[model samples]
Target: MAATSLSLQIDARWRAATTPPDRPCGMEDIETASSSVVIVRGKEADGSGFWVTPSIVMTNNHVVDHNPDLKVGKDFPATVLATDSVRDIALLSVPNVYPEPVPLRGIEEMPRLADDLYVIGHPIGRNLTVSKGIVSALTNDDYDDRQYIQTDAAISSGSSGGPVVDRCGRVVGMATQTLRGAENVGYAIAWSQLSSHMDRMLKVVEGSSPEERELTYPSDQTEVVAKYYSTLGAGELAEAYDFYSASRKARLPYESWAQGLGKTVFIRLVSVTPGDKSNSVKVHFYSTEEVNAETWEWRTGEFEGTWTLTREGGLWKMNESNIKDITKPTTSP
Candidate 1:
């Protein structure tokens, strides 16, 4: 069946009405944003529980791994679309339409500390519960350089994969972790980090192989792709180059190619099709920059290229010469 467009407003009402009246109330805008939330049910050691959405579910690898019955196929009702152990993020496909799929906004664009935020999910079997609070701090406890969105939003068990919306109802993060000793203190995997994973999933979705019955991408590949965008954020052009194949790096050197380009460039992996043991990856990139001392310029472009890796001295290196056609789209992001 064709997929349906999930509407946030409709889902929000559904969630608000279902939640307990005793909990702190969520904003009207937040209810409108709750349509994307969902309850993920499966038999784990902890028994059955719920999860929320953007249609992208994430949890600690251990939570999922602990449940040996939680196989990617069969037992785990949903598809294990993609996973990134480093970030401890996983993407699952919900066959049914949500009516609304929340968009992931960048971390730099998120609200400041003490700003109000809301967490929507099923806690203790009560689905669609909404918890509200303010950003307490931005901590990088693990030193991943990726800051966790620490908030007082009353997150409890079974809140994983739920939407953490800002006052405006825009999703700024996903409920991922929480502290056991602290009250109402929980952490969310920033939306920016989640987007990087979604981008890779989109590519897999767009480029399904005929022989492959399910949608899945290598965790390592997803990491490389996510890291590539992260590098772009820090203006580390050379580091970003490492993710690309050797030929791509040579042709599109960071310093020379990005010289006139903007400081920030948006990248979306469009698709990844199979190619004789390799893969054909398509990407869409949007860049904005100042053309001169006067005005700024904005451009939307797309790139399509084939990717392959070869083992050299027991190490896999991206084969630069394997890159094929790279196109630039005529639109903007």
Candidate 2:
């Protein structure tokens, strides 16, 4: 079946608000908060959407998964504020200061299965658009102790990181994944997950002076080791090792270094496990080049590798890497 094409229309009123006056506010004051939504465009991948809070902006981890050059802060060339991948969520601080932060609904206040839900995002690179649907189900299929809010909302590629609102227009979760063979079958990371991870991420980004918080990369010595994998057409491995943490690099050199690899060794990112402030990001990439006329050969195999990263002088660097094999189902000849 042909995929559905969705488009968004840019509304100036929906842009992030710059100034919010101080005073006792009412529902009318909060209703005008639509300006907090912003469009995030990555240089290496398709543009994704995100919404803003007073101190941070939120987006999906997959959106910024491929581009290591992406950064947060006023000097950032891109439109993003900040990102966290472990939760498949990112936060961005607006360039121009805004008064009020976007309000978040408490986990206890979230909706139940089959409840009404709404989503707002820039679908298909158009403009701000709102889609409505119902909460399909609730499941713990993805992560332990964390529940996922399933919805029938029309979430597309560019819709990642957008807000999923409840009946009263309060955000209940962040839009994340979808099923391929289904219609309007989309999933969102519940607010509980966000509440669990937001504090740590905020501390890392806002704890120290802005100058003290910078992404780290591996040293020249590690780069030499990484280049070995890169020579094997493992660009993802090379890049993964470049971002490994010091301790991980020292312990599991090859495995940690190769963990960021994908199936085909292509530089495009398929998935990532964004580690905490002290840990490294586990990235999965796919090779664009085909191995043969029939079957394609992946970088490490079917499964991707895991790499470690550490912070050195405020920048994130690779520590170690290793490759693992993935098994694929056999087809009759």
Candidate 3:
């Protein structure tokens, strides 16, 4: 579980192309691509994890199994959502929402051999860092159906569960291990091998507990309103988006929802009550916002609204948010 240093053979040609004249690509560019990565520390083991969904973080199973006190709902920073030891993958439910989730590239989307790649994680318990390399080959592993992406991306003892991203910043694999006694050689669980496991893991996350079910797939109208606003208030746009009716979300799109509410500072739930209609919930809340990222201007508003909800795919979702008025946006001088 202890951390070890690693050496990677950075492709000189690729590095030159990615790096700017004054600013090198190694530290700055890698850090930007690592926004979704988190330092996962347990009692016995510590590693890295990347946000796959608003609430879910993906890492290696061995990392969790090595930790003695880390368990679902027992840990402070995160809880176990699901694990597949055979596949060496684990999903943890984190408390804070990530600004964005790492885009998971599917098997069909695998990059070509010799393409530049980057692995981002906290190596040797250091702050998140990046190592550069090239895809050497695509090879099958001990597992019958699993495939591995061979790369020279420098990864160490603490790098397990971190992401191996393509030049375009799409996650192509999860750094799993490095060949012992070898130089600049590492192995990753390809997205092709991970996609099926991820599908099953998410289902386990939704069905594991009643609280999770209510949070992800509520049957009651009150629960739908409560969960949606709560997630939104926490800045969990992707998870909150799931609480929207498919049709409405399709029309608005996640990108627009994120941008529209980008300046939201906070949301306070005042009350939720049954509406005139059976599937609607009247919601009351107060919100604060920054007018712009550059300016210090602030505004406060109250939203009195009724959310029309409907059942879809066995979960209650809000079809629309009808805010009657903002009650005057009080600006700070």
Taking all chains together, each candidate's TM-score versus the true structure is 0.50, 0.62, 0.51
Q: Report the error of model 3 at residue 123, Å.
A: 0.8
What RMSD does each model have against the real structure? 15.2, 10.5, 21.2
- Model 2 segments more than 4 A misplaced: 1-33, 44-52, 67-82, 98-107, 206-212, 215-238, 244-293, 296-311, 314-316, 320-333
List runs of model 3 lying over 4 Å from the truth: 1-31, 69-76, 98-108, 209-333
Q: In candidate 2, what are the lDDT values of residues 1-333, reduced to their tens digit? A: 000110111123423222333654444432443354555666564434344344346778667655545533223444333344335666554433445444433333557777877776767656776788898888774433556799999998777877776654456788887899998999888876775565555544443333232332112222222333333453545554544456665676767435533234343334555444345444544345445635654222344566565556555455655545453666699
TM-score of 1: 0.50
- The lDDT of model 1 is 0.53
Error of 3 at 22 (Å): 24
> In order, what lDDT does every prediction score?
0.53, 0.53, 0.69
Alpha-carbon error at 101 in model 2, in Å?
5.9
Model 1 superposed RMSD (Cα): 15.2
Highest-scoring model, lDDT:
3
The number of clashing residue pairs in each candidate reads 11, 52, 0
**What range of 10 consecutive residues in model 2 has the weakest lDDT sum?**
1-10
Tell me, by TM-score, which candidate is best: 2
Put down candidate 1 lDDT per residue, 1-333, tens digits, no spaces.
112221111234323433224545457667766654555555662211223344444444324532433422123355554455446565555444444345333332656899989887777535568888999987774433465799988877767657787865666787777888878779887766665655665454444332222313333443434445445644677755665665656677667767744645454434333445543322233333334535556444444454555433322334542434345445676
For residue 220, model 2's alpha carbon misses the true position, in angstroms, by 21
| Per-residue lDDT of 54 in model 3 | 50
Candidate 3 pairs with clashing backbones: none
For lDDT, candidate 2 versus 3, the one ahead is 3
